[model samples]
Target: MVMRTLAASLLSIGVIVTSMQVSAANEPIQPIKPVKPENAELVELGKMLFFDPRLSKSGFISCNSCHNLSMGGTDNIKTSIGHKWQQGPINAPTVLNASMNLAQFWDGRAKDLKEQAGGPIANPGEMASTHDMAVKVIKSIPQYQAQFDKAFGSKEVDIDRVTTAIAAFEETLVTPDSRFDKWLEGDKDALTKEELEGYKLFKSSGCTKCHNGPVVGGNSFEKMGVYKPYKTDNPAVGRMEVTGKEDDRFVFKVPTLRNVELTYPYFHDGGAASLEEAVEIMGKLQVNREFNKEEIANIVAFLKTLTGKQPDFKLPILPPSNNSTPKPQPFE
Candidate 1:
């Protein structure tokens, strides 16, 4: 009798283990891996550039101005405040996990972070400084040239090098180890019953069709209003601006939902104010389905579980400006 009981216990344990393995394998979303350390000097240089408002024409706006690290890697506003307090055309996406994106920008115009880094510096609405001027300003700073030598084996600072440093630093801003990742890793208790149910609904409702991957999105371009039109006063033509094709109208790169709870108001236009509203809007516009109150609530709970550990580091202290440093022409 004792032998039979022990055999039965072993069998049950085997079954449970197999079940957990299967459950893990069946999930579409993957956990974000922690960013491995790259060149320390290069990353440090990038960090300084990321924080230095000298990259902007006004000398007051930095990358952190729009993508604030303390506030879930986003500015937490409907639209970003840009040069001369100008409202940006579209809402700013969070910089956290942006390195995982296949392409940068809503239109996917810039091929990678390196390419994207040079854009806002010259964009009239954003940073409003020419790349040539940006380089000249950085070159004027002797300390920056020293740091450049340490990073790139040369003191020669150019726009390409400047963007490369910024991109290198941006790549380090990844968030990992969320509660959902714990659940995905086979810790069955990581999520509440409602949250788990919500995950099921999220998959069944076709949210995972676009939002599948380590970052839980940013994998492909999708039309925003598949089932119906997404009404917005914002005049972004989406990927049509990039491809210049009428068929690509309303198409945009799906944004990451990794830290959705904190990165609101939601959407390219910042139309939806709350997660509940966002979920409902997504369902109706993307999937042509109307989720009830309970469904929206549970889905939101699951989304909250995706808020992972954010990047932690001391703010970089920038080099002091000297007489050679180019003056910021904010008014002119």
Candidate 2:
């Protein structure tokens, strides 16, 4: 009887260990922690700059032009429209939760949000403005100068400080408390049966291999077509242009699935117009499997659960330019 009791206790301990392992395997993606900016003054200043088209050579295209907050942090177009209506090569990725990305841009070129902030301003096709000109425009505005002095403890308004303030504002662009986050927090009822099954299928089909993270992606760079080639007419060569490595061709930063439903026209080229089509294509190209209509729908449902609370803030009224301010060269 004593021997039998000891054996039973050992079996019970083994069962508990196995159960714990299964529970751990069920949760791979973590929840996002919403971060607020420590420097409220800097964030407010950045907000003005973000919405101020004066930063652009055309004095029309602002950071909000491509990354519209009302439209899920993207322009919702296949490609962005730039200065003089020059078409952008690749789709504009959403800025929501962008600070969580390993690197900025589809090619993972920019090291951080601050570095990424300067790219479009100088890109001839985008803002069509130089750093020196951008500083001059801001400095000329007396109201802006006062704000800069208060925010930075200096009246100086250089590109570095400008981008730093913008990055600070962007750092607070996180969307937390989604249904998926609730599920991750041990709320079993947060997700439906169908959604749960879809998540299981997603893991079993190896979709989570690349898309597993707090952001459900954006943690690393991955080839657009791992199992097969992705066809696109877009001329951008992905990471190859940055790394100059033949193997880096077609390797782009994996975008986050958070608020994906709102950021339609999927992929770098924005070839897949619908979420269903994007899921089907990803399954075929990345997993080498063709998902049925039901599977696709279920997966899309799971993806929708990633939508979180959007940022809430009042629109900033930009300071008007004075006589010293350089006139915008919209036509020039």
Candidate 3:
């Protein structure tokens, strides 16, 4: 009778262990959803505007110059080259899954993508175009006038409407259905054993504390180095510039880790050139733990699994500017 009782207990324990393992296999991060724009016409107009170089004062730079959709929604440069080859202060973050961020930009200064759109246009180092000039340039185009009318139900092409439409299109740039996402959806075999081990280590080592959620790390602001100071020549004081708070000096928005494999040259300073280096640096700075070479490789393997499906859309054909349209002043 004791032997039978022992066997039954062992069976019960096995069942319990299996149930827990199955539950843990499920993901905490949510999958990206297909975008359904309220105004498809507006999205179309925004797409044209997004690709049009005429929006810049120089007429040489467009939104796509830095945020190239063909290249992981980033220029893949350490820092962006702006108007007249002016170097930007920080690295250009990927625009993919940007709408998933709690706020836009590394500093989190802009509340949304719409507000973020207007900054570079006016920044002297960036597009170097005043809001009024951008509006005037767009207005000068007859085709743009018709598009504006169709999009907003009025021919009034203003910065607000322009940014609104741009933001609408940007909202559709979600990347979904990565291998990690597939594993998250309960496809047990979606990830390799090494990748699964890396994920377990990633969580066990406390990466998930900051990198959890749909976009996997854009939800909040954190200091660049929690355990040690991050050394960089970049003069940007991070969130301190935005909030003017002393404690917020090193604080910056946590970039999303989705497609991190593609958005290389990591961090605001773009210091870490490879995934392994970035992982090691992050582990050392954030958690005060130094990841070994094998550990770094495992983490990188897991990170590569985060690459999702890129947005698929035809290149937009921008409306032509008429003779009355103000010509771009690239040198001036």
lDDT of each: 0.91, 0.90, 0.89
Candidate 2, residue 185: lDDT:
71
Model 3 error, position 256 (Å): 0.3
Tens digits of per-residue lDDT for model 3, 1-332: 99788777877778644443434235556766667898989999999999988889999888888899888888888999988899999999999999999999999999999999998888889899999999999999989999999999999999999999989999999898899887776677889998988898898888988888889899999999999999999988889999999999989999999999899789998888999999999999997889898889899999999999997999888777888999999998
Our tally of clashes for model 1 stands at 0
Per-model clash counts, in order, read 0, 0, 0
- Against the true structure, candidate 3 has what lDDT? 0.89
Q: Note the residue pairs that clash in candidate 2.
A: none
Candidates in order: C-alpha RMSD to true structure: 2.5, 3.6, 3.5
TM-score sort, best first: 1, 3, 2
Best by TM-score: 1
User: Please, what's the RMSD in Å of model 1?
Assistant: 2.5
lDDT by residue (tens digit), candidate 1, 1-332: 99788777877778647554425557789998888757889999999999999999999998889988889888988889999999998889888999999999989999999999999899989999999989999999999999999999999999999999999998988888899998888778899999988999999999999998999999899999999999999999999999999999989999999999989999998888899999999999998899999999999999999999987889889998889888998887
TM-score of 3: 0.93
Those runs of model 3 whose alpha carbons end farther than 4 Å from true positions after fitting are 1-26
Q: List where candidate 1 sits over 4 angstroms from the true fold.
A: 1-15, 21-23
